[model samples]
Target: MKNLALFDLDHTLLPIDSDYEWGQFLVRIGAVDPVEFKRSNDAFFAQYQAGTLDPVEYLEFALGTLARFPRPQLDAMHAQFMREVIEPALLPQARKLLQDHLDAGDLVCIITATNRFVTAPIAKALGVEHLIAAVPEEDEHGNLTGKLLGSPTSGPGKVTHTHAWLEQIGTPLDGFGRSHFYSDSHNDIPLLSVVTHPVATNPNAALSAHATSLGWPLLQLFND
Candidate 1:
């Protein structure tokens, strides 16, 4: 009986990408060495913005970076980063919009390509009801194994997870007469195409072109 409001996290809800922010935070906190990992991170991010990066390859690269630190350290670093860096990056208007959806009793979800480890806390902080994100696997001893548990939630994979989440909650695709999806990347084309209302928020160049061609509404909350 409830409508769905699915949002892509990176560049959509927050002004910047969550994963990259986490990585940079790790560097600043000494969990990761910036001098050593900067090149890989920069290259990976460049490809990500261009929308040509392979999710699996990027995950492999990022997860491998986690091998340098223990789970306990990673956890502590994540908590610190969430408090200091991630939370501050959220736009005030974006938070208000999320609250408005919650006030209206809509089911809110974050459908992102970022892994669950890096995104779950942020989603919980925002009081999101559901999250569909790539998750890394862990070893029996509770250490990250540098492997993804399933398909990365990007492109077509996003559509699959969004539908699966809806089905799990018994919300038929057509049940929500006026469903909505907000994203900032063309990578979300598959998921955005299915929703009745598609909004492009702080869209990148490629997404802007696609949004223009489709006549979807565009919103830029921050000048930068």
Candidate 2:
């Protein structure tokens, strides 16, 4: 009998949203030209939230943002960003909560809409054992080919991916016996519905309403 814990990144584990903050950070660090960066970033984000952008195109465009930097430089930048920016974004309580789960020996996994290449390091940093994230298609030469291996992980896609992972682990959908999921957006409703304990963390309006209606617990992390 195992207890499974599925965590949402961005607003759930961290107090801030990663995608928006990453764009702003790139501008500040001169990684991108401010105006053009913001314009492209905003548009892509809009399309992503609306579920219109294909995973491949989205990942290629995002990776292209790092085109000027070689892998080594980008890796160093990612490390710095995680230490100075991402680390600060985590709430003290949330950190402690995750630690408690780890101490209890539960299987903790991150289920996010973010692409695997971008998030794999962060997931490693967080000490999470597993990650179920959007996977970009790759070419034989190991370049990003701008395609998706599967549907983007969001809405119902979250549940779909999660169930498959569970099956792979030889754990049925309900195998956890006691399971918990934490997320911040209404967009996660499909995934929320499948969990035994669904927590709304700094939810958006729709999720807040749904949580209230379902009598699910709501948690607020940081003020901003």
Candidate 3:
């Protein structure tokens, strides 16, 4: 049987929330009104941390940036984002964690609630081949529609998406002798509960408490 290692992209691996950083990136580039965008962005992130975020509303705010610019322009900005913002957050410990799983012949993948447009490059930069994220819809003209194409890969949705992805690849979760999931949010509890190994990396208050109760391993990849 194969071994599978799954990682959450945001606080778990990167030490910061990618979706919130993407919003800040747009504001820094003058793509949106700083005052209004920051306010909304902070609010959305707060709700996310509280485990009460409405996925649709958060996507409306985050994916809306893609619709405002052409694909080429957005791509270029994302490249800059990778260099300036995300690169610094990719700690050596996180790389080692991923490498350890790979060395053990485990298939590694990132599962994030963030939209694909924002996380795809980040995953590539981190040398991850597979990524499961919210799909941002595109229009007939190949432009972003500022909408989600399917269910958001968050909370219980992560479990659903993981099963669907496995089915598409002609492998069932049971085919894996061991399955590990590293995450930082309480929202990830549903998926974590079902995995063979559930690691809480830099967990939030709720997740920290839950992990303690469950006796799950706690990790801090960002410590300098």
Candidate 4:
């Protein structure tokens, strides 16, 4: 069986938070109100870093922004985000690590708490085929519905979601010869614990402490 490799998107593979950056991108482009939108965005991000994030509440705000625009406009804006914001943050070491996994014929997947709408293209750009992320609902007309369709992939849900995704793909979690999860946040500890090899990739202070205590490998993909 192929070895399973799971990577957290924000702060693990990339140095910045993609979801938060996307919000700031919108604000910078005048697509969102500068004051109130930014205030709420910063507030939610603070909660996330503090490990007290309410995924549902953040999702409501994030998805609602998507719901306000047509798919075409969102796509255009995201394309700009990729060029202006994400492109700069992409590190050679991160790309190399992903490529090494692919070369080893591992089942590489980016499992993130960010909604699929925001993270899908980023995953595609990184050349990863499979992605497990928060699901956003769409209307029959192909417009965003401003609602979450399934369990949020944060905290403990990451473990369950990974299991479900693996099962759906005909591979049980225990079936792998070796499974690995790389993450930066303590919120992903549940998933990290379940994997055979838990790597702290550019970990935050909390995760750094936890991983250090567990003797998990620390991987710093960026110089800074």
Candidate 5:
């Protein structure tokens, strides 16, 4: 039987939150007003940390920037963002963790609440072929619609999306003899609870306590 390794992006593989950093990147590039965008961005990030984030509202705020610009411009900006922000945030330990899974012949994948547009490239950078993330809707003209194509892969929704992805690939979760999921937030509990091995990677206070209680392995990928 095959082994499966799933990873959460923000704070797990990377040191910073990709969605929040993406907003700051847009502000730095003057694509959005710093004061206004920062206020909303900080609030959304706070809610996410507290595990009270309203996915619809946050998606509207995050994806609205894509809706305002053409794909070419957004693509260029995302490329720069990846080079300047995301690349530097990639921790050596995180890469090693992914490599360990690969070496073990596990099917590795990234499951994140961040939209596909932002995370797809990040996944490619990490050499992960499979990604399960929030899907951003596009209009008939190939422009963002500032809406989600489906339910956001967050909190309990992560489990739902994972199941859907497995079914789409003609495999069920039970097919894996040993399934591992690494995450940093308590929001991933639903998926974590289902996995055979739930490792807490650089977990927050809440997640740390929860993982401790469950005797899950705690890993700190970024010390710098």
Candidate 6:
């Protein structure tokens, strides 16, 4: 009877939204037009918070830059992005929480709406082996297509992808003695409802109210 631990990356383990920050990072580095990119990025982030985000449209916007740059340069840029943007957000409390799950030998996975291109390195940095993210397609030339390869791991798709991933790994959601999901948005409610322990972590107003009504546990990883 193994325990399963699932985490949402943005606003759950991290106090900030990594996807939106990555967009701002590109803007800061002059890789993209500051005015235009920021405008679209902020809009999509707002839609995400509202739980009305269309994952496909968001990915088209987010991954468009990936197609314009060569892999080597993209890799280097991401390296800088990690150091300048992500490193500071990897707070002690979040690290300790991840460590606790690892030390307990729980089957840990990060299930996020963020794309694989942006999140893979972050997952590696966090020492997480399993990630379910919106996967971008690569061409025969090994170039990004700026399109999703499968269903976006978001909203209802979170439950679908998690179940599919678990099936592939030979462990269904109910197979574990206990399953835990930590998330911050109402967008994740579908998956949260299915898990044995659903933690409203750094929850937004909607999720806070929902969790409170349901008597779910609330955790603030970034509480000062």
* Candidate that scores best on lDDT: 4
lDDT of 6 by residue, 21-132 (tens): 9999999999998999899999999898888889888888887878888777888999999999899988889989999999998999999999998899988999999999
lDDT of 1 at 191: 83
Q: What's each prediction's TM-score?
A: 0.94, 0.86, 0.97, 0.98, 0.97, 0.97
> What is the C-alpha lDDT profile of model 2 across 33-130, one tens digit per residue?
89998898888877755646565566667666655565566677778777878877666777777888899888999999887766777778777869
lDDT score, candidate 5, position 57: 87
Which pairs clash (backbone N, Cα, C closer than 3 Å) in model 4?
none
* Pick by TM-score: 4 or 5, better one: 4
Each model's backbone clash number:
0, 0, 0, 0, 0, 0
Better of 1 and 6 by TM-score: 6
Over 4 Å off, model 5: none
In candidate 5, what are the lDDT values of residues 1-224, reduced to their tens digit?
A: 88999999999999999989999999999999899999999999999988899988898788887788998888999999999999999878889999999999999999999999999999999999999999999878777888888888999999999999999988799899999999999999999999999999999999999999999999988864
Across 63-100, the per-residue lDDT of candidate 3 in tens digits comes to 87689888878888989998999999988899999999
- State which candidate has the highest TM-score: 4
Tens-digit per-residue lDDT, 40-147, candidate 1: 788889998887899999999788877667789888888888889887887678888899999998888899999988999989888886899998888887778888
Worst 10 residues of 4 by lDDT: 215-224
Residue 66 displacement (Å), model 4: 0.8
Candidate 4 residue runs with Cα over 4 Å from true position: none
Candidates sorted by lDDT, best first: 4, 5, 6, 3, 1, 2
The window of 10 residues in a row where model 3 has the poorest summed lDDT is 56-65
Model 2 ranges off by over 4 Å: 46-57, 66-69, 138-146
lDDT of 4 by residue, 158-203 (tens): 9989999998999999999999999999999999999999999999
